[model samples]
Target: MRSSLHVLYLSLANLLITLSITLPSPVQTAGTVLVRRSDDGMWHPERYGGGAPKVNNPPSPGPALAASTIHPIPSPTLLEATGLIPFSAPLETTHPIPSSLPVEPKEPLRTIKEPEPHESPLISADKFNKAMTAANFPVPSSEQHVAFVASTKKAKITSALEAAMYLAHLLWESHGLQEVVERACVNSACPGSYISDLDVKGKRYFGRGYIQLTWAKNYLEASKGIYEDDRLLQHPEMVSENSTVSWETAAWYWGAKVHDAAASGNFGRTTAEINGPLECRGGWSGAEAARSRFRLFTTIAPIFGAPGPFLEAGCY
Candidate 1:
């Protein structure tokens, strides 16, 4: 009975050893990979499986994704067309996406304040009336006086001398601001065919405005400078018909061409600017007119309190 019992124990021990060698692990039988906790504290596929799951052991990394294989989200237009989003609705996102469109920088506009009615300076009404009386010019209406002051200011006639010189020219050309349009001869002897196109409309560019602005080209240029268009060319009579337009055109011409020469106190130089071909050259046909202009300048200068012994008036 003892020998039989001993034999059974020996046999039982041998059977246990064989079972342990031949039987598969629970995970292996389930066909699942053994997982270990990584440094990030997450469970991942283990390097090898035999003992308990590791705390920090991690598997080798897989192949990386290619740049070409990556895709971006559809454009707003495409998404709207496909009915993914309502038309004109703003796109929603987890993160605020930066705009790819270029932003244009805008320039700030400059503003100029308009002057008040009584804001006349340098060329005051009392002084102008005195000057007109002294020059034997016709007494201008109150409206005419105001218009003259405004026009001078627009021409940037800051000094008394500039005012006197400008007035002298206007007095000579416009006949003391009485005749806005030139008194041209009716016959073919008069200056009418300056620009053939202007004559087609019966628009004579002989002489008009305060400085007697002549020629179609001058009218066109002044129109562009003042109105920023060719309206003056089309309606040449506006230079004489519209007082504001007339005065502004003269002011534009003075500021652009004659102001600098007048500032030099050289009467003849200013004459040359107005009619160089006719009056400036020695022994020219309009030498008499040049002398007349000089006389007017000398006469008006003292009235406006301009300091003299001025330069002798001649083209040279």
Candidate 2:
């Protein structure tokens, strides 16, 4: 019985070995093997079947190809129009950026305000008259003397008064008392008629106004920064009508070297005393007129805080 059992076991083992050699293994069913085509267009399995899908015929290739390579095709026009192109790439450009271009920051809006107007410096007639009265001279009875004095040789009344007033103020500021100038005016020998003409040789010379700014050379020089013409010196009355011109001329005369001697001291005492001389020529009498004219300045000085001759005499 043991012998028969051994022979049966040997037969069973041989049958198992034959089945293993004929049928595919379990590993073959788990994976696939690739099949490649030959140049002749025939396909043959390169590896044993491992439960993979079957391919019937080899695919035809027109050109030689590299292993593991791919070729991309252009997108269809219809697909591009519909914005459905697959794997579309963006284009690259090479434009340069401008260096001066400013990047403005956005700001919220706001409101703004406007500016105001300006005013002038002219004084009123009442204030001027009052100022003159305060200086201590009797006001002229009529514009007559002022007018005659101004019109003496084509001199404008307004211009004469303005010049007279300007000189009076300057003199008053330079001198503490207006009486000194008044005394010079009443006593001086300078001709009144000649004082009206503005021409150098026309007779009227250095009539009214400060320093008796006489002579064509002196007038011309004084007028340099003051008036357009030195002829105004020939007719000193123009200084009154034209305030700007009058002030400029006054400043120049008072500050000049030629008049330095007479203009010395706070009251311009030297000039007043000189004008007081009776033997003087030309507008020497006008110096006395200037003294009278100074009365107006004396009256006005307090109101304007103008310095007396003493205070105004020193160089600034």
Candidate 3:
């Protein structure tokens, strides 16, 4: 025990001597220490710190170690997410080898997709309807309005202008006629003009279809020419129920020969031609029904680019 104490004191004194060596004037830190170091201020293989591999001067060739004396280098891949490489001691290998092959970079994560929306309404189905409504247009029937829209493309009528004019008159004939009579012809009663003349063979025929297919003779003649069936003379209400037949009858009256009075866009004159005998009998200004027809034409004409009424009458 006394000899072992003397040996421990010699070892401690040798450690103190090794630690007293200072860095040389040329020594500076690069990534790892590049300068050769010695213990006890003398040249020898005992480096103070775990020394770096030599740069300008390689380390001396070492003797092959016995297999049992070797240790595996710590793998860089063993690092935890804390970014620490756990090594209980200095990293060393049986032979100098590359530190864990250059760490491979990772790819980024994928994101979810979303739906896209449309930008403009120029190609929408209700584009025309919305525009006309914004302009405060009084569209008649949806069916008739569609006809007007279609006319802008292919023009089943002469033009959209003609379709507008045609639809305006039809609108008045079917929906606005009563209002016209109530507003102005209250005293004269335009529909009652043919009072006794309205019935034939016990089936009282009032104004029934577009433009009011009034009078039994008119119904019989229209049904024969337009439907090729005279049955409407006895059942005139069928005219109101069958829109196609009613409109066909009106078209027939419009295109049948020529009423010079309806020539061109003489709107007031057209009113006179269509129902003058009943409503315009008192003269233009007094003809409320004629004036109402003109009112509708004025509102609808511009939408279809129809020229304004070239000839003005007091009724318009």
Using lDDT as the measure, the top candidate is: 1
TM-score of each model, in listed order: 0.58, 0.30, 0.45
107-216: candidate 3 lDDT, tens digit per residue: 86777676677543211235334434533454345574444343323312454445444545666776632221222333443544444543554455566655666667
Leading candidate by TM-score: 1
lDDT on C-alpha atoms for all candidate structures: 0.68, 0.40, 0.50
Write the number of the candidate with greater TM-score, choosing between 2 and 3.
Answer: 3
Two-way TM-score contest, 1 vs 2, winner: 1
Q: Please, what are the lDDT tens digits per residue for candidate 1 over residues 113-165?
A: 87667654676678788888888987778887788888887787888887888
Q: Which residue runs of candidate 2 sit more than 4 Å off their true CA positions?
A: 1-129, 133-212, 225-244, 257-265, 268-301, 306-316
- Of 1 and 2, the candidate ahead on lDDT is 1
lDDT of 2 by residue, 1-316 (tens): 9999977876676445335433322222111333444555343443221223343332332223223211122224433444432322221212321222233567866656555554322333344455545655454333423332332222211222233334354445324222212233434524553342335554434333333444445556666655566556555445434544444554555444423343332333433433434322336565555455344544554554444442223211
Candidate 3 regions exceeding 4 Å error are: 1-142, 146-157, 176-200, 257-261, 283-286, 313-316
Model 1 lDDT at residue 86: 25
Candidate 1 yields a Cα-based lDDT of 0.68
Query: Model 2: which ten-residue window has the lowest total lDDT?
Result: 88-97
Model 2 reaches what TM-score against the true structure?
0.30
